[model samples]
Every structure is written in C-alpha cells, then in structure tokens.
Target: MLARTTDPIVAIATASGRGAVGIVRVSGARLAPLISVICGRSLKPREASYLPFRDAGGEAIDHGLAIHFPAPHSYTGEDVLELQAHGGPVVLQLLLARCLEAAVESDASTGQPRLPGLRVAQPGEFSQRAFLNGKIDLAQAEAIADLIDASTEAAARSAGRSLSGAFSQEIHTLRDALIHLRMLVEATLDFPEEEIDFLQKADAEGQLATLQAQLGAVQQRARQGALLREGIKVVIAGQPNAGKSSLLNALAGAELAIVSPIPGTTRDVVSQTIQIQGVPLHVVDTAGLRESTDLVEQIGVARAWGQIEGADAVLFLHDLTRSAGTDYAQADADILRLLSEKLPAGVPVLDLWSKQDAAPSTGPVTGMSLSAKTGFGIEALRQRLLEVAGWQAVPEGVYLARARHVQALSRVGEHLILAAEHLAARAQSLDLLAEELRLAQNALNEITGEFGADDLLGVIFSRFCIGK
Candidate 1:
C-alpha cells in the first residue's frame, strides 16, 4: 500500500451480484485522457453522459452512463470516472477488462500510453487514498466499513455519525483542551525560577481538572459505543436436563440446539446472537457439566468448562425439580465451586432456576425462575442480560466505536492521571507533567491519523472490502 499510493487504479465498485445497476470506477492523478478513450469524448466535469462504452475496434461493449469528477473534488481527492452499466456479471467483467485495455492504449497524438500505471485497486485502497489526501480521517474511514457491515439499525446509525465526524469532533475538542494545558506547563517549565507562580496564575490545576472531567465523559460514551459494535459473549452451563438447550431455544426464538430427555444430549456448544435494544448478545449453550465415565461426555464437560472460563458472563442454570435431594445439592455445590475457581474475577455469574413450571412449591428460593417451555421469565432474563453487558442506551444515541478507540481513551486517561499528579508536584516535576500531556495528545492524534504508524494504517485499511 505504501509503495503504490501514487499509482492510478480501477475496480468494480458495486457489490457482486445481479442488480439494476453496477458501477466500474477509476481514480488517478489525471483521468481525463483515459475518460476520453473509454468514454469516447471529453466528459463535462461531475456530469453524467449516456454513451456507448466501446472496445478497441470501436464496437459497443455496453451502453452506460459516464460521470467524471475532476481532481481535488472527488472521493479520493483525485480525477475519477465512474461507468454505470447494466448489472450483469459477464457485462461488468467485459467493462472492467475494457478499462485496463483502454488505459494502456497508445494516444494517437503522442504515441505514448493513454494512462500509465492504471491497475486494479486493492481492497480499501480507495478509502486509504481519501485519508492520505485529506478528504477524511482514519475514524471516518473505519466508519465506512462499519456502516456497511452493521447488523442492527442502531449500529448503522452510530456508524453514520462517526463517518460524519461526530466522534472525531469530540476527540478534537479533547485534544485542543489538552494542548492548552500542555502549553501552560511547558511555558512555565522554560523559566524554573517562576514556574510555581506561573502555573498558579494560569490556573493549570483547574485546567487539568476540567480536562480530566471531559475525558471521563468521552470515555463513558466511547465504551457504550464499543459495546454496540462488539457485544458480549455469554455462556450457559449447568447439570444435564436443566433446560439449558431449552433456554437457548427460547432466547433465540428458534430451536438452535437439540432438546431431549437424555442427560448427555448436548455434546458440544451451540451458539446464537440475539439483540436487546439493538445491543447484540452472542450466547453460547454448552453441554451439561457433570462427572461422567463415558469418554464423550467427559470431553463435552471439558469443552463446557472451556467456554465458561472465557465468557463475559455465565448463566448457571439449576434444576429446581431436583432441589430436594442431598446428592443433587452436593452436585450443585461442586459446580459452583468450579465456577468460582475457573472464572475470572468480576465476571458476573447469574444463577437461574430452570423448569419453574415443574418445580415443587417447597425449596430454597434463589435466583430468577424461568420455564423455557412456557416462556416464563424470559423477558426479565433478557433485561438482566443487558445489565450484565453494561449497556446504557445513551439518550443522545451511541456512535459506533471499536475496541481500539476505547483502549486509546483509557491510555489517554492514564496519561492525564500522571500529568495531574506531576502537576501537583509543582517545580519538582514540571518536565514530567509536560511529557505526560504530550503523550496524551499523541494518543488523541492517533484516532484521527494525525499521528500513527504505517503498519497500523495498513492493518486498518486492509479490513475494508474491495473497491471501497
């Protein structure tokens, strides 16, 4: 990508399939010559002209609409041409090939190639070019892909906000505030004799406090936005015939897992995604946990433990009907002990009493009771799941954000904390305070591509679909 940023490129811009229309797009430093060759005439800037897309022999390959965008006013900040042709696989392929052929055809006037170095575009190269040329920043470029791949309406809307620079604007505001404080600290550092007096008069402590408060607010929203993009993973584990599979089927509204009276029916994990208030929940139903002599059941139990350990949350289902027996109580206690031993700290484990419709009226009452067969307590269970996920459903609505954004903000907060501590130290650590503030600003710049590594940029753009 770094090697070919200057080269002219072309691609089939629309998704692969039959539709009413398909577009073949080209971007380069100069496309007027290539446009004249393929389009057969000089196109009016930014205007669509209906004409025959001709082959080298002057025969019509397809009739299409040709639109031209002059340099510096296009998606990639380059001269661009788009051919809107009939949506047919064969026809589009022919048009795509014709573009390559026409680009290399010698000009009649100069005996030179019509457009040198025209090649097929790499996945996301177009958007990468836009970023490189200042048409958009890194966050907005990522939002383009997020919007396209969004699984829910809320996710899509949030991606649109990020693409429109809402998230970037917030980052910029934080950066500006950080810069002001850094300026104050660095100015005071230049004169050690009056450093203490300088900061006090400039209200550096108050400024840093305000910055931290603003950062806390941004971090809260960014966390919520990230949850919308990357939802929580939930694992359901319990003894056999506890209705774990039934509960899964109920939650997903489909029979994704097998339901049988046999104790070891579920021998592997079954997964589904359900949305609560447009926040996705990736739920996994694991095989029943128990001591089993059978080799297959042992393996299933082991796999269930594996899933349980990695989950963001666990739903430990209990068989209420078996609550009266001492042996059953011992088994429940054993499972609970293992859960505590294997699961990470702070990972919530919600104990649920299954088969509520069949349980005897007398037993220890604990946890939420629900019968998957009758759909009892399912709504409350869903709301509980949302709470475990830490979703706030912000009133202003969330803008789509990635895990990296959350991590970056966390790092910024860390730096600010150190900056404040160093600031309070006064003349003893003015240099340290300035350094932390500069580091914080760099983290902020990373989200906008104002400061970043090349490999990071490559990894980012590579995730995009081709011809974006």
Candidate 2:
C-alpha cells in the first residue's frame, strides 16, 4: 500500500492466463534506458516497434511489440513502456524480471544505475498516479475500475460515460454555480450601509432555487447509476412445498435449485445471479422454513434467516393451494409473526402466492398470485422487484455512480438547504450563508478529488487490480 509515484513500476497488464498475447507495463519518470537495456533498442514515442526482449545474459526472453510513451503524454503523465509478448506466464515473468534487473544494473561509464528504484506496481497505483498527475479526477479514476468490472453492457457504457467526464462535468457545473452565489453573498458583506438591496438586485434567492432544482436532478440520476453499479441482493424464503425453488428456477430460466414434492428437499442455500433489464439480481434460494427434527435442516433454517437479515429484499412465497387448510393457516400466521419481529427494517418483503393454477377461489386474496411452473405473473413480479428497488428506465447520458457519490450529493443538498435558510435572514446572516455555500462546494469537490484525504485515496486505489 506504500506507493511512491516517483518509483518506476512494472506489472503484468493483462489477465493471468494463457492467451494470444500478454502485456508487461512499466511507468516512471524516465524509461529510455530501461527500454534500451531490455528491448535492445530505444523505442520511438507512441510508436509500436517489433523487438526481441532480452535478459541480463543477452539472451532473448521473448519477441514482442515495444511501445514507448514520453512524459506528460502517457496515461500516468510519465514515461511509459509496454512489451506485448506471447501470453505465457513464464514468458511474461521473465520479461518482468529483466525490466527490474535492467533498472538496478549500473551503467558502465556513469557508474549509476541504468534505472534506479524500480519496483512492482501496487494495485491501482497506475490510476492513482494518473489522478495525482492531473490526467483525470477521482470520479474518473473510479470509473476506470468500474468499467473493467462492469457486469452488464449498460453498466459498462455508463462507466465509460463517467470516465469520459460526463459525471465530472455535471459536478463542475454545480460547483461553478455555488461559487457564483458565494461571490454575490460575500460582495454584499463588504458594504453594510450602502442600502443598495444587493440580494434583491443580484437575484440570489432565484439562483438558490434553481441550484436546488438542478441538484435534485443530478441526485436522481446518481441514484439510478448506483443501482446499476451495486445491484440488489434478494432472498427467497417460504415453508417446504411452497414453490420457492420453482420460483427461483422460473426467474433464472433454468433448474438452478432442486425441486421436489418431499418436504425439506432443500437443506442448503442455493444462489444464482440473474439480470432484469440490465440490473443484476443476486437471488438466493434457502431451505424451507418450518419445524424440523433433523439437525442439518435446523442449521439450514437458521442460515436462511441469517440470509434474510442481510438481504435487500425478501420473497415470502405462500402455497396458494393450501391456503384453505387450518394447519396451513396456523403455520402461515407463525411465519408472518416471525417476519414481523425478526426481519430487518427497510428491506421490502414481497408476499407471493404460488401455485395459482391449482388454488381454489378463496374469498379474499392478498399479494400477487403466480404459477412458477407455468411462468404466469413472472413479468409482473420482476417489475415489482424493480419498483421496490427504486430503479428507473435507463435514460440517455446515464453515467455510472457509486454510493459515495450519492452520499456526497446528499450532503451538498443538505448544505444548500441550510444556505437557503441563512439567506432568508438577508444581511443579518450573510456570513452563515457564505459558510453554508462554502461547505456545499467542499462536498462537491470531494467527488472529483479537488479535496480528498490520503487515507481515502489509499482505500480507493487499493481495490483496483494491479496494472490498472
């Protein structure tokens, strides 16, 4: 985690495995000598040249394409070298070692190391350097990782937009507006006895109203973006023979969970990830919730409740066919009571009546009735889940956002609201109004790394894969 931007660093740039080609990337202040020693020739800036990568013994380690990027024009705003060789672990490792060896070896005449202080790059060190070098902001740096790890095509495209400065631009616009408003407020403070009605003349109140509306719009988009990034976790819970497994299979479009008429057939949790309109849904099918004598089933029931507690949503499946029976009614009432007392707050529970095809027309029915065997009411159920999740239809210019961004925007909104309250006091509270505006701007600045702590930077970049 101790990353020095000045140190020359190298890492395998591509994924680990046998492929058609693998890449070894090096970034530093000066890489010309390292390139010459390893590639046997100085590379032209930004041009790919076919060369033989050599070792300290002057033996060819691999023949590959060498490309050089000079300082201030590279991804990290430093001199960079890339060696694309055969995609074998051994070959890549040899090339990586030679780069390190060349950096430490002394030059014959100068008696100085060819490339001093070369080291293996830490996870996300490359992107962190890019941020430090003014190549990209914090939000854009995070987007780079998000783009690589995106699960769906929509998520990838949204991350691309964020990386391209779409999200940053929106933040910049809001910050600029706040700055203008702060300037107006501060100007009035300089002259108290002028009686010029500065606040009225400058339309400060109108501007504040507009800024609040714009912030709301941005927050709406950010929430949708966050949903696309993190998705949702859903746990399916019900008594044995309630068609919980069948519902799981229906939603996944495959037999992911075992389904049988025997009670307690599922004695463990089964999970599957399925997407609904590009949003990933991690679905977990747990053991049937009921009184059991077996030890394993008891353990599974406990685990099922554990999963429910941590879930973003819960699907409480009820056997519609058995709704008329007194014993079934009593069991259902017990499960409801348990859910009322034990389920986590804010997690939406969908009451689904399964086996709609065989259910007798009882007097009054609650919740959606669906037959997993026939795929009936499945689409409605999917839509309901999305609604509970606060997901909206994908809109144009949608960009990827994280929970941190949403929280920052929320803070900004709070500060702006407080600023408005101070502004209502006019000249008496001008100083407090100015302070609120400044606070709002600072929160917005954190989103783009205009103001960020060292510890925050470390935590962010540490999650990135090496060579990113």
Candidate 3:
C-alpha cells in the first residue's frame, strides 16, 4: 500500500487502567469536527490548549489538555487530535466514550465526508499507517514497538537508536554494495562472450568478497542486538549441596532462594532476571541433580535436567568440599560429564565452584571460585556473562530484535556464502545469485516490515495492548 486515507481511527492511546493522565487519540479528515463537538471549541492545530471534557448532556467529565495536529504532518500522516484527561479508570472510559460519540455525530453531518465512527484501531495500526505514509520505515515502526516493550534501559536505548534510523543506515549501506555487484553481474550477462572473463576478473571477485565481509559484520552486530532484546536463559544445575541456591541468591543480590548447608534444601527451580552490562540473564536455579531414593528429590532432578536442555547457558555448579575424596564426588563428576553431553553445541558451560566461604581456594578444577557470602569473583562472572551473551559495553547504538531478525540475517549470510561460491567457480549462476540476493533482501525487509504481509502485520500488532 502506498498511502492510506484518513479514516478517523480512534483509540485510547495511553495505557489502560489508572494513571496520572490518559489520552484519547482521534485521527482522520473528520478529526477537527469531532474535536469541536467533544470539546465545544475548535482546536488550534499543534497547540496544546486546556479544555473541559464533556458528556452528551454537556456535563463535565474532567478538564485536561487538547492538542491538534494537521494532516500530512501528524504521526499517521493525517489530521490528529489528542484529548488528555485525568487518568481515572471511569473518567478515561467516559472521556473515550465522548470522543467516539462526537466522531459518530460529526460523520453523519453534511460535507464532513462519511468516515468510520471512531473505529477501534488494531494493535500498531497507527504506527503501520505511519510506515505506509513514508513518515517512518518498517524498521522504525518495529522499533517503536520494541521501545515500548523493552525490559531494560539498554534495550530501550537500542530501540530508540533503531527508530532514529541507525540500524537502517547500516543495512542500506550493505544493500547498496549488493546492488552494485548485482548490476555488474547483470551487465556481464548481457554479453555472453565476455561473461567468463568478467566473472574471473580480480576486481569482480574482490568486490563480492568485500560485500560478504560487510554483510558478515552487520550480521554479528545484529545478533548481539537480538541477544540484548530477547535475553538469554541460563540454568544452574549440579549435585545436591553444590551451592546452587547460593549462586542464585548471590546473583540476585537478595534472598530470592533459600540457601542452606543441608543437602536437598531446594526442591524446585528458582528463577530471576539479572542484567549484566545491559543484557538480561534469565537465571534458573534448579534442584541439584543426583541419585536419590526420595520421590521428591528425583522429581527435582528431572526438572533440573529439563531446564538444562532448554537453557542458552548452563552453570554447572560443583561443591569442591563435597568432592574431596568422597564416593559422592565420583558420582558428581559423572553427572557433570553427562550434563555436558546434553548441552547443544555453541551453548556456553561455566563451572561454578561454590561455598567459597568454607573452601575459598579449592575447586573441582580451574572453574571460577564464587562465594555466596563474600561476593567474590561476582564482577568477573558478570563480565563472563556479557562475553558469553556477546554484549558490548561500548555505547555504539544498539536495537532490540527478535528471533525472526536473527533467522533472516542467518539466511542472508548463507546467501552471501552461496553467491561467493558461485562467483569463485566462474559458473553461470547469475540466476541463483539473483534469487539469493532477492531472498536476502526480503529477509532484511521483514526486519522493518518493508515487504510485510498483511497477516504478518496483524499477528505482530495483535500482541500490543488494547487501546494502544
């Protein structure tokens, strides 16, 4: 769709429930008349004017600010009106009802143009319209949603950067390089006689190499941004009395989990979100894994294994004191090896030697010595987490991204490799190269919804809260 006509969509733009202020937003060609009817005064465009909200009977609902934005300059590229009112649940509902009523009444009048009587906006519809109108691209639209849903300051800032076009600039740079190479290939295809020679030219091959490298760099940074946005889940697993709970408590900086010297103290997984250098570490503290006759202990161990398999990282905690020449020590080591085999390749495994307060120097191996009591090596652990998660502390602009973005980038990487191979072999694979390039472009488009299907937009925007 190139652009959308102003259809006068209205929604409570503020969050639902009680707040300090709530906004009832109306947009379309009919916006001015609707505001006049609701506020009993014509609103000056772009000016925030104090106005009293009124009911159909002319009874006051509450007084608040009213701001009008004229068409072609507003968020949706249409005439927009905002009614800010005291944010009481009932008061906001009344305010919204008044706006809807005013819009319906205005639409029925002559010369106003028949418009939808303040139809409820679909999730992200306003932003979607902005995207369609060229007010913002697909990436910036997605970034607006990301900024709203961000769970950390880092993620929020990243989304803000993306909204401001930082991410798009990089993607476009890579895309321009791809376009240049595609043109070169297309030019060669026109002359069959020189095709072989053109394909083998050192300059042609070097250009492709450079394009691939640029795509690779962007892919790496995008992956890091994805991790920052989506977060990584880490599971803490080990034999009983392995300081599993202690580690959890230490990471949480609170008594989130009960830590005792007694074996099998925790019979359930305790989870918490820890931010390390702006990356969220969803730490799951599971019951220690070991052979147990008790049904409860066995169940806990099973749950621990379940967590281990699904985790992005696993902190395999081992009690050095318990492993000092004991029968349980050998059994524990065997369990650790088994756990290692269960992990997927590329997922990091950290050996955490806990209970450092008692045995501060002893560990199963060169594993990190961490104490729940003294907070030793905790900073190092934080640094390790940032490293494992590929989080950079450098203030280079970052943005939150979903798994969809990663999958697209991965496909782009694959296409780059294939293109490079086709070019290297001096084969007439222009068709394949073009197809890959198109696929790669489509995948990138999904990041910003450039080629987003209506259904995909529906699914994405449906996740937003009603009245957004």
TM-score of each: 0.97, 0.97, 0.92
Clashes of each: 0, 0, 3
Question: How far is 283's C-alpha from truth in model 1 (Å)?
Answer: 0.6
Better of 1 and 3 by lDDT: 1
Distance from true location, Cα of 387 in model 2, Å? 1.2
TM-score of 1: 0.97
Q: What would the per-residue lDDT of candidate 2 be over residues 1-468, giving only the tens digit for each residue?
A: 437778889999989989999999999976877887888878888999998899998889989899999999999988889899999999998888888888999877578898899999999999999999999999999999999999998899999999999999999999999999988888898877887877889899999999999999999988989989998999999889899999999999999999999989999999998888878889999998999899999999999999888899999998888888899989888988898788778878889999987764642267898989788899999999889889897667679999999999999999999999999998788999999999999999999999988888999999999888
Model 3: per-residue Cα lDDT over 174-261, one tens digit each: 7777777777776677777753566556377788788778777777777878887888898888888888888888888888998777
Lowest lDDT block of 10, candidate 2: 357-366
How well is each residue in 52-99 modelled by candidate 1, as lDDT tens digits? Answer: 999888889899899999989999999889999998878898999988
Return the TM-score for candidate 3, rounded to 2 decimals: 0.92
| lDDT ranking from best candidate downward | 2, 1, 3
The lDDT per prediction is 0.90, 0.90, 0.77
